[model samples]
Target chain A: MSQTHVVPTRVYYTIFAILMFCTYLTVQVAFLDLGALNTVAALAIAVFKAVLVVLFFMHVKYSTRLTWVVVIGGAFWLGILLALTMTDYLSRAWGTFG
Target chain B: MLPDAVEHHHPALAHQFDSLAQQREAAALGMWVFLVTEVLFFGGLFATYAVYRWWYPDAFAAASHELDILLGGTNTAVLITSSLTMALAVHSAQLGRRRLLLLFLIATMALGCVFLGIKGVEYYHKFVEHHVPGPGFEFEAAYARQAQIFFSLYFIMTGLHAVHMIIGIGIMLAMFWMSWRGRITADYYNPIEVSGLYWHFVDIVWIFLFPLLYLIGRHA
Candidate 1:
């Protein structure tokens, strides 16, 4: 295990702390009047935070490519599910229907 | 053996697995699957939120403003700390630091309790203001039923996440006791690591939940 695992503990934690602070900044940015860009900004920061969790906290950085595929595959399928469902759900023309 | 001592898989494998590598793979894979399900589960709520936001944008925004940003932000920080401790707990197990393992487990559990306690306080605030949405739930006339829908989803989504937190605390408590008995170690720490996975996934869920429930479109 020692021979194979190369990243030091401090590096992992430093990145974790950095990602957390970025998340905090994203949260604080919500208080400002960003108008139409508010959701976009929060979600962009969220994706960054999710990447940090996946890479470091969950050891994806140290995991095999196969493992990364498994993890990413889950995320991909989730996106598909969300996309298909929301297309139908959101596109319902309210007053157009009799 | 206690009832909880159901099976360890094999004597050569700590009665929990056919082999160390297999046990590790199974535990990690199982957690991934569970997390996928959770994604779908919470995805439903997120979809509902988006749909409702489209329909009742003002009401949803108004109700979101009612959420105490202090509690939400503090809870986010608290949960991130707990995740840090949880990752550290797994690291201690990997390094075979038995005492440190217990310490981190206790620390993680304590942080989890703080999260639930804060959430309980938030729920109490909601209750005092009649934010709990249902048949008798009160809503200002401007909202009609839309604001109530927002609160209904809020309670259900956050309430379900809170239930996961309580279960997470229980898992950590059990692991703490097991650690006391020398059951968890570098070689046989799959369960510990898996519990950390669950805890971290829960933390990740809240990561998104916080932004969606509290932060999205609130800059009006």
Candidate 2:
């Protein structure tokens, strides 16, 4: 008799509100004069929002660690693919033509 | 031995499983595996975007800057809200709150429609601006060739995502009807849970998409 633990309804609703606000904040980051830091700031905000969604929206935070593994594994693999590929592509002309 | 008397058991279930709960877990894991493949699919497209953005930095930035931040940001808000509604819908199903589940599902679909509508407007703007890639598609001279590449990735990535949105909407319609017909109960609500996962995955995709397509080259 395994019982799943569900989050309290109010908590879930509160997380949703916070996620909406975070998404709005990502947009607001654009209007700031961060200069070269704008991209960094925007991406950092996006990551924060993504964390909130994964933790609360998905309920992975309360689930078994195996569930978290599946998710983090998927994301980490994608990171690897993007990183290794860009290493070649972004550095193609680093010391050469221009 | 039918326990056809059992409230939750269906004849379709295989005997190996102890309960519908096990079956549902297997089904969910299968769906997640399918989603892994989906990751690889979009992975290819993102790789292409990265290569092109780096190769033609100026053009990519200019194209991104042309994007309406209001539209992009609004859509981001719309999508995150939809994900919230989706999560709520699943929560309702878990709690056996049928009416609440229906309400959340409808809310999710409405928000989804808003996203596509805004996207349609953006596409229309692109058409009017001749930013679409192909013949008769023109751009400022400094970024003529690469800008087209940028739009090419733009259309392809977001276009595929839009197609998925349409499919998700269709699925939601079917789920809504089934729920209305009393086919789904708290005990047999795996369909809703599965749909929620798909919806969340789409939201996650857009989470990445906002940065790649709308933010990456903007400051350039």
Candidate 3:
């Protein structure tokens, strides 16, 4: 029989607490004046929260290597979509054409 | 009858799979693939939001300020709590704790509804304020047109997310009933596990949305 790993319940509680705290931190930080750092801070916090959720709540941390591949691949593809399109759109302002 | 025909069977295991683990693995992989496509679907909208925000940074920032951050933040916390409940539900399922499973499932669904109810209040506020992005839409004349674009994307993205929440709530209800009947067991809880994945994905989307939409120009 193949063994299934059961995560301890306390771990879920810990992650939940961390997530709630991060939410509060993000909202509080948004009230500060930090110029461009505001956007950077907000997005960075959001990404951090997302990583915690995916790794802990979704059990990708305890999942198989194949599952890791799927998760990373999805994120990689999304990066490609966002980066490639932004490069084109943002560069349009440089006036390359006469 | 052939000897092979007399082989013992596990109720949840399909005949094609060599073992239950393999069946569960296949199901998890299939769900992950579907979730990847979902990421792409929402990724496009995120891209659109980026383009418009870039084009009209001032208007985007100004328009963002008009949004009620308190409400958005509350909804974010609510959704995160629901995800916690969802993860707990999956945990309960894995342990074959029927009562705990049902309790967490109901908690998750109730939280989802609460999030939606708050969203409804926000939308009603928008309607009364004429922020619904149409002919009747109103904003400062200087940024009215650009702000309209902002409101348009806001409605589309959040509306789609709300629709997903509605679907998720329905799924939780069904699972709640199934758990009540004892269809879920320690040996077979793929439905709860996969649904947890879906629920977490939705929560992840909002995790991004709340910051992107509500925190844009708050400091300005």
Measured by lDDT, the strongest candidate is 3
Docking quality of model 1: it rates as: acceptable
lDDT value for candidate 2? 0.80
The TM-score leader among the candidates is 3
Supply candidate 1's per-residue lDDT for B211: 80
- Where does candidate 3 clash, by residue pair? none
Instruction: List DockQ, one per candidate, in order.
Output: 0.47, 0.46, 0.79
TM-score of 1: 0.89
Total clashing pairs for each candidate: 4, 0, 0
lDDT of 1 by residue, B1-220 (tens): 6654445344326455556776676677778777778878887787777788778888888788778878988888888888888888888888779999999999999999999999999999989988888666776789848889888888988888999999999999999999899988677677787898788888887887788778756666
Give per-residue CA lDDT, model 1, range A1-98, as digits (tens).
22224346796679668867977798789988988788878888887887787777777787666677778888887788778877877778865887
Q: Which pairs of residues have clashing backbones in candidate 1?
A: B8-B15, B8-B16, B9-B15, B9-B16
TM-score per candidate, in order?
0.89, 0.89, 0.96
Worst 10 residues of 1 chain B by lDDT: B3-12
**DockQ leader:** 3
Model 2 stretches with alpha carbons more than 4 Å out: A33-36, A95-98, B1-14, B216-220
Candidate 3 chain A: minimum summed lDDT over ten consecutive residues — where?
A: A1-10
